[model samples]
Target: MLLYTESKEARRDVVRKEHDIIMLIGDSLHDFAAEFKNKESTEYQRGLVAKEAAHFGNDWIVMPNASYGSWSKSELKMWNEKAEK
Candidate 1:
């Protein structure tokens, strides 16, 4: 089997082998996947969160930062869309 460090998405993939990732703690959902990082619609990301809702407090710990990060970017996108309406 190929080591994650040898994979194409090395930065993200390498961490999988480096740690025992039982829980994810981050300021952005994007920390979990490329789809989340790629700026998909908020509804889509929320749906994924809903699907994994049971894991929030346990397997996932999201600390949204207002100062900066994907949370801020997504919020800005939402604000811009609302303004355009």
Candidate 2:
């Protein structure tokens, strides 16, 4: 059996061992594949998503994320900043 490091795709080694077609379902892009795990920049990652628009909902399904998401890297502030301290 081939190890994940030995495989080209970022899929798990166990998944790689299978011969059947695989469909990925996840809340994050990286959960689907490493190509979506680009470390360059968020813009670049979005660009990649645009490039693979056709594959979305067809090949891999992205589930909804209920909690705080990974897309927002900005410094967070209190939702309600009070006035007249």
Candidate 2 local lDDT, residue 13:
46
Q: lDDT of model 1 at residue 79?
A: 41
Question: What Cα-based lDDT does every candidate model obtain?
Answer: 0.67, 0.68
Model 1 lDDT per residue over 1-31, tens place:
3454542345556657776668767777765
lDDT value, residue 71 of candidate 2: 54
Worst 10 residues of 2 by lDDT: 1-10
RMSD of each: 6.8, 7.4
Judge candidate 2 against the unseen true structure and give its global Cα lDDT, from 0 to 1.
0.68
TM-score of 1: 0.57
- Residue 78 displacement (Å), model 1: 14
Instruction: Give lDDT for model 1.
Output: 0.67
